[model samples]
Target: MPTGVALHDVRGQLFDAAERVLVREGPSALTSRAVTLEAGCAKGVLHRHFADFDDFLAELVRDRVARIDGHAAALRESAGTGTVTDNLTRVLPDLFDPVAVAVVSLVTSRDGLRARLREARPVGVPILTDAATAIASYLTAERELGRIAEDADVGTLAPTLIGAAHMLFADRQGVPPEAEDIGKVVNAVIAGVR
Candidate 1:
């Protein structure tokens, strides 16, 4: 935010500001006014774009979910090209970033926001489900190429992997897990499956 700076992609600006606040100050710092001040927009701009603070938060979480989902989808291209651990290590931790964890916590704490999210979907945030599906899809493709063991239970393992990753990320608080740490987790998971 600055003097006389034109607002472009105000939605993205607000979301980015919201993320910075959530990461730097924690979930309690998230508020319409806080986001507007951080984004350098009119105090009312956030309210103007969404029905309420909860709605704004839902959208923010949705945006992050979509971006991470897209990353998982792209993992298909790396199928059979790398070890399963390598491919998963490259992406699973991306799902558990501090901003993402804070957004999820923010949404879950507010019943109204969580309800709106459920109304928009079927259950909890789809980040994990999306990742699981993406991982399963990649595994299936690899199986076809004889990369994965035919006996591997991808259907069961994919979700288990995602859940483990979720725990790993949730435990991080604000500190980001290093790629090596992710590699270790992925290695442990893959060792069980392979």
Candidate 2:
């Protein structure tokens, strides 16, 4: 007798394949046929798993955002032991690293993929903003404890700092900061709080 698999199992495999294709070939290469082929299934397999390519791409963005949010949560949970700057230094590199840059570039470029990203915006924005807020909150706490300048505008500063990290990682101009260099930049930004 032949073995059988559940529908959800097959659907998960299709999504997994779509992720690999998006990560490896960028958004332009993602198509129903491509994803089905990558998943080692019939052409209709992708449609059965997803209503269409747009649906697949939407799920992809959601999945990536969730992963990033989870990482941010882990960092936030461990942030108590270190200085605000120290915790940020430890976390930003992983969040805005080269692989993440590549993923962002792909998602933001294709129209269908971009629409999916927009659909996921409600979830993604809060995840990203929460990470920024966590950093800002840490800064605010440090200020209260007298470790940082009392008048510092952490609300504005945190997003600026995160934006800078994003730029550095996405710097296609080939002048992106090294990890140590990013540390220096972050430290300088935090130090200028006064």
Candidate 3:
């Protein structure tokens, strides 16, 4: 193992490596050694940056979660412009990207990682829960605009959409569902409220 190699943005490199490992090999293959190897760095480098493997995994999850905040903002912003179904259909692919799906699996499979994440994310499964919240907020904005039914329950609808979408995208051997297929799902879920 090479020591003292100058690697810029080590944390980002390791995280990106971890995501690649997760997406390609699934959670069982994720380890400190795997991450460092994928990053092409000395194993000690990972320890130098993170307290431990679980800590690194937790940070990786938090990093992904922060992305949802940005997506949520953009989804909320598109509340009144496009068709309700179109707005939602566009966001699902992003929210359920290969890395995000693999992260959800990693978090669920690792007891330590899940416990560590509870400090920052006390409720809901890390990425999926946040995605649901984003959907709920977008639906709420639509309801306010009279695009969604006034009586529609955004709370229930949000999770329902997330669960439905998750099933469609989960464990697909890398091939994503067609946009038209996803649009049909979005339409079916929100049809009652539209």
Candidate 4:
């Protein structure tokens, strides 16, 4: 008999497990065995769902990236409500959460994973690229509402903010940056535009 789970939603269970492994041990530790162990499922559980380890990783990345759409919508909805700095400060950490940073490392370190991801995300790194686009869209909304300067270069500003937040959050291992630190960076990035 096969040793594994017959649980519903196994893909979600495995993805969550992989994120835990990524945050706790970084990308090098994210093997299918490690993920199954973290998930408390048998090793073959992963192989059953995915063609291979890289396929699982690519799907994991895509699932996370798809979440950015929801975030982007929420951020855009807040365009006229909060201060631009406050809105951005709140969203940056969400965008650069520990799992996301680890995913970036995973994508960069594994060429096979990168190649697999490129079919859907051909331009930039997976999570970060989608995040930058989300930020840009939010900033554009704010600009249209007269919250940010009409002259604000949202295209340029979005990536700059993402890059800065990525640096701050990426250095902490599994720990997140303080809200104060994130606020400072957000304030600085939007200062010229506001």
Q: Give each prediction's root-mean-square deviation over alpha carbons.
A: 2.4, 4.1, 1.0, 1.7
Query: How much is the lDDT of residue 190 in candidate 2?
Result: 83
Cα lDDT, model 1, residue 54: 85
Q: Look at candidate 4 and tell me the lDDT of residue 135.
A: 93
lDDT of each: 0.78, 0.67, 0.93, 0.88
List the candidates ranked by TM-score, beginning with the highest: 3, 4, 1, 2
Whole-model lDDT, model 1: 0.78
Worst 10 residues of 2 by lDDT: 1-10
lDDT of 2 by residue, 67-147 (tens): 676666666565446666667777887776544565576666676666666664644443345557666766676677676
lDDT, ranked from best to worst: 3, 4, 1, 2
lDDT digits (tens) for residues 67-161 of candidate 4 = 88888999989998968888888888888877888888999989999999888767898888889899999999988988889999999999898
The alpha-carbon lDDT assigned to residue 78 of candidate 3 equals: 99
Per-residue lDDT, model 2, residue 186, is 83
The collision pairs in model 4 are: none
Give the per-residue lDDT digits (tens) of candidate 3, residues 1-194: 66778999999999999999999899999999999999999999999999999999999999998999988999999999979999999999999999999999999999998899898778899889999999999999999999989999999999999999999899737589999999999999999999
**Which residue pairs overlap in candidate 2's backbone?**
none
TM-score of 1: 0.87
Model 2 CA deviation exceeding 4 Å by range: 1-8, 97-99, 119-134, 137-147, 171-178
Off by over 4 Å in 3: none
Expressed as tens digits, the lDDT of each residue in 1-194 for candidate 1 is 45455778989999999999987787777788899998888877788789888889889878988887677777888887878788888877676677777776676667777788888787645566667888888888777877778877888878888887777788525466778987887777767546
Q: What is residue 185's positional error in candidate 1, in angstroms? A: 1.8
Cα error, candidate 3, residue 64 (Å): 0.4
